[model samples]
Target: MSYESITLATIAEKTSISRPSIYHYYDKKESVFVDLIIQEYREWGEQMGPLLERRCSQEQF
Candidate 1:
């Protein structure tokens, strides 16, 4: 979905976390965007951490 289609409520629902809990860490929806991006990126990086340390052909990469 497009960024415009996503909302704090959407995130809260998907994560099963309350809106109030999310708001506690974020002052605004944009802040939620930043946190979500960073959190997902970090999780992705962690899952792909080993691959990052390995050297492979560009095609394989």
Candidate 2:
């Protein structure tokens, strides 16, 4: 979601979590965005780990 559109109130409404609870985990909304980026990298690494170890041809790569 766009940064301007993903406010804490909107997130809480969508997730059904309280706004104060969300704040307990993230000091600011930007921190949540940073954590999401980190999580995406970790999940991508998990999915790519085996493929990366294999010797694939350029066509496969």
Candidate 3:
């Protein structure tokens, strides 16, 4: 579900979670987006790390 840059009220409506609860987790909507982006980057790095390592080993061989 690609939810575009959304306001807190929109997120609350989509999630069915109270706006206060969202606020409890994230101070602002930007913070929530940033957290998600960082998490995605970390996951991508983890998935690619082994591939990169193997490439380096092949180059050294």
What C-alpha lDDT values do all the predictions have? 0.84, 0.87, 0.81
How many clashing residue pairs appear in each of the predictions shown? 0, 0, 0
**How many Å off is the CA of 35 in candidate 2?**
1.0
Model 1 lDDT per residue over 10-51, tens place: 878888999989778877678877877999999999989998
User: For candidate 1, which ten residues in a row score worst on lDDT?
Assistant: 22-31
TM-score of each: 0.57, 0.83, 0.69
- Candidate structures ordered by lDDT, highest first: 2, 1, 3
Global lDDT of model 3: 0.81
lDDT per residue, candidate 2, 1-61, as tens digits? 7878788777778889999998789777788878989999999999999998999998997
Candidate 3 lDDT over 1-61, as tens digits, reads: 4456677777788889998888788877888789889999999999988787774665663
Off by over 4 Å in 2: none
Instruction: Extract clashing residue pairs from model 1.
Output: none
Off by over 4 Å in 3: 1-5, 56-61
In candidate 1 the C-alpha lDDT for residue 55 amounts to 100
By TM-score, the best candidate is 2
